[model samples]
Target: MEKYGVEVQEKKQVKEEGLQELPGTHENIVLRFAPNPSGPLHIGHSRAAVPNAEYVKRHNGKLILRIEDTDPKRVYEDAYEMIPEDLKWLGINPDEIVYQSDRFDIYYDHARQLIEKGAAYMCTCDGAAFKELKDNCKACPCRDNSVEKNLELWDKFDTMDAGEAVLRVKTDINHKNPAIRDWVAMRLVDETHPRLGNKYRIYPMMNFSVSVDDHLMGMTHVLRGKDHLANSEKQKYLYDHMGWDLPEFIHYGRLKMEDIALSTSKALEGIENGTYSGWDDPRLGTLRAVARRGIDPRTIYNLITEIGVKMADSAISWKKIYGLNRNLLEPIANRYFFVEDPQLIEVKNYEGGKVIVERPLHADHMDRGNRLLPFDGSAYLAKSDIADGVFRLMDAVNVDIKGDEITYNSTSFEDARDLKARIIQWVPAEDNVNVTIVMDDASLKTGLGEAALSDLNVGDIVQFERVGFARLDEIKDNELVFYYAHK
Candidate 1:
């Protein structure tokens, strides 16, 4: 085998056994969403996961969820379970689930084969020296080491200190991409893996292990970010050497959202430092955070599919995303009145007894039914919901209020809509229910909601008439807690 030169592949090499193309049938495809168990799935992950899961479904194929838990240092105990839960919440179910830590023997077997074939060697070069060589496109002294010596060093993973040895694949040292030159296939990690503990010190580097797994797992197509194109090329060397057919590669561009803290490191760091509540903290960009802020999973699916599998990076604004969701929510979300920063005003001509008021759950969706509110002598209104003049109390009779003076007017919905009256939301004092609205910014707004809100269960999405759409989080005692989604 010539060092730093492409090897001639066997002429009659065919696809692996069991992966043979069927007669009069299509190639059975398999897709995957491989997320390392380091953190919960973020919106950026959704961009990757949605397409993989969607393609498998459309093609009537399989979607394997391979947890890239090979990096012992980055793995977290909670994330192993949390990642799957987040995916389940988003309605993405994997056909097969695998953990890399469980497949160490498989990776080790493949690594040994490469070493025996003189296709890979163990290099003892330090980080600084390797950087210097990489900078100058110079091959390190260990690049010419004998196969027997490299195999001896590779077998010493149990005794060698971490970073004492690295198993490097044979590649062009003068390759245009410095990062691609003789890529490390395996390295000794000192850290105790969350799942594997210190049971294994020899860890297979990403491309080496991924190539092995994809071939053995029968992955037919790989749909991933364009950033992984270089990785795909590097992995191809392993496939061609092992006489495995290359999987169909469909690389899409990155999807970045404006104002979102997309870095998993920063988000996880914030959580650990008490800067964020958890993975679901509204300040973070994780899918749990988006759901906690009341964005629907169905909406997320539609958002990603709309972008499709593009070649160019897609930059999106949160406003556009919420605007689309608002349209989807309006028809289904029940309407209620909630008065925050509540100001009380006395209805001057009101009788002592309460006046019954019927408010429709949805003005256009009559099938949603109505809720009844009672007005005695006073009404609660949001300070921002009213002007200094007469306005129609939404779904009820017209009310004239200047400063604190409040007087009743006509009971015509036609007049309110026709005159383009300023529609204000109000909760009669008798029908007020203490409520807390959690805004997307993580602030809590205390308000008084219509008592009818008591019928709403947790997870129900409701609109606060003139306010915004909010998802019910909880109800304790007489108070209703909601997560304000968007208008």
Candidate 2:
């Protein structure tokens, strides 16, 4: 009754109720998101996570969060801690958490079992000699070694230096895909792991480790990039040798985002050289960056769901993602007047110079209430929003400009909404709040916002009328600093 190496989960029969029955979700599917902790969780990683979580929910299945942190050289302490936080931010909570490093002994046990079964053998062949042999489709001489001797060398991995010996799973040396031929099952790594810190020497490569873990953890289905199609075939060989059921492998296309760095190494280097502010830099495609830009988690979830489990590569356009996000935010984000690169406009020849303009928080959603924008004859408008003849200060008032003379039109709100007037965002020049927008490329756009914006709490996402969607990051010195999500 063991479940994922621990508590037993009661399996429920899956009920099909959807558009298309996926390849591997016919039963009590146990899916997982195995992320190597060498970097933060990027959007590419979420492509695996959010959809799998939906499968577990829809199919009454269990989901495992397996941290594949066996590669010591590239592992980072920050990455190890940051990954789960990012997943939680994406609304993913695993039913079980498995750390590969914590189960070194378990992987060792399976490796030894494969050796005893003659499915794997230890190779002491010199690197150059073995490469030539493998290149020529010839088995290493060590492949024919006796079981007792193979086990002996396997145990002596501790006494041997890093490259002196390795354990190779026995496969057809003439395998069609050369990369899958005689893959390394276990090898001595001389480096210390960030977590384990020299606790073990011999380590299993990704293929053997993932194959073994998936089987041992009772994984019923696997959704991954087609780049691992070869690896999946190699693992199938191992599964066949071990007399195990092959998990349903639903391959998917690559999710490529243009002009966004997803490589952990490249991002780290950028951060090191001050090219990026941090992992949450707006330029990155990491979940932290996406979240910082105020894109909703549901935006990512829905996007991946649309991608589904297809076996083709997809280069998702930034415009598509932003467009999707804008759709979600427009309905909920409260509207504000943000004047960018302000141009001063004075209303003259008026009966009373001051007017308190009342605008709805959302034009379509008057139920949410309104904001009080007071203009004492002086207001600021966007330099681009200014035209020579006529315009309306959105929800505020209508003014007619003729030869440096601005004449205040009727102050009736209904007339302004009906005149077919060119409506533009405006703020009182004297009492406006300082608004600083952090754009996607990390540049700052400083402007004036209606003083009503001062009431917004941090983390409140709003749309500046005619500007774009932005998330308030912080409030300081009577100014609101926001991260621009999208227009």
Candidate 3:
């Protein structure tokens, strides 16, 4: 289950430290996973959610689920609904759901107070104008407007056109980073928000809403992507200016690489352009895709735990993830029979009787017991395994096939002992049982006609006979069912 490169010895030391008792009583600490409702969450988001949830659980604290739906135009209904479900699928439960769109008045009230205190001002410069002006350029004429005039203009949100002007937090333009230099706090948006209809016009940006909410909600510790480390400094500045207490900031590295794009906008573009099937495409590192691929949440959690809280950025290979999943599922999965590309074989010279052969449901585990399989003097086997004009039948006999007829050379069953290549799976071809297996579109190509077993009820995990572990998605009557398997 170890995905990270950390040594087992080191992990034991860390685990021992984590198991030690805390020096003080647990505080009423609150951590948050503030995902923007712009697109489906990818695997990078899972990295954050897993650790934050684990930390909260370890310390007996609260994990708040916050939807940063500040962008009116970009917010999607599906994104908001799927986020909580995805987190729950990963075993991370939140104590409360908070939407930034619901607190526009609070953001505005604080924005206005900053204006009254001469800490913020309205800027009429558009994007092009600001880009041309740059840092050395003169401040817009509206920057010097009286706070009373700004308040009067702010109240006219109902009449203002979108992007006509914006409220900017007052910061030194000469600051090292341009983001700290009078960043926009709020702007008018004419589009309707999915959650909050058209009740308001102006919306707060990430810098504004995150700072205000984190302080108000009493978030004692913040764990976020490393890209926000610089933004944290700006937030710290805001807290200092407002005489508010600041929280301990922990910035972890992002999971990214040149080939992989974690951006929601990029993912949407891929979906639209047919570069990917959907957000849950197996090729994409999204939580839904990982879950659908049968990777357990415990494995994902263990990977993050092994990686620990490091500031260095790293990209994980897909093989490593799959390997960990295989390890976690190996001991628990059962064994069964599955014959793909089945070829029928008819017995020619039998002793006028049907012979029943039984094999245990699980190998090396007697508790699983056995199932009766009808067999005659002959049995169908996979055609691909036959080689060089010779066929081995469980090593007990050798057969030659010519013109749909198989000729056996040996008659003793003892000769088949310990024949690894001869071992194969079989199902009753004469049986009337029917099963329909549902798989991701990507896997459908290579997995066709491979004894796909799907006759399972919901919540049932059955061995795919010999293929792998499969869980029943849904079952209709006793004939048809849909199943998903873990590789």
- Each model's TM-score? 0.90, 0.92, 0.83
Candidate order (lDDT): 2, 1, 3
Residue-wise C-alpha lDDT for candidate 1, range 408-474, written one tens digit per residue: 7655888777656788888887767899998887889998998899988898999987679998988
TM-score of 2: 0.92
Clash count in backbone of candidate 2: 1
Clashes of 3: 6
Error of 2 at 145 (Å): 0.8
List model 2 lDDT by residue over 1-487, tens digit each: 3455443233444534431356754688899999888789899998889878888887789999999987898788898789889989988888998889998898899988998999999999998899888988999899999889999988888899889988988888898778888888898897989889988888889998999999999999998889899989889889987889999987888888888746988998999999999999999989999898899988888788777777778887889889889888889999989988887888875566677888899988999998988877778877777766666777667788776677788666677767667777888877788889999999999888988898889989999877899999999997889999988
The candidate that achieves the highest lDDT relative to the unseen native structure: 2
Candidate 1 segments exceeding 4 Å error: 1-26, 351-353, 410-421
- Candidate 3 weakest ten by summed lDDT: 444-453
- The Cα error of candidate 1 at residue 429, in Å, is 0.9
Residue 4, candidate 1: alpha-carbon lDDT: 27
Q: Cα-based RMSD of the predictions, in order?
A: 8.0, 6.3, 6.0
Write the number of the candidate with greater TM-score, choosing between 1 and 3: 1
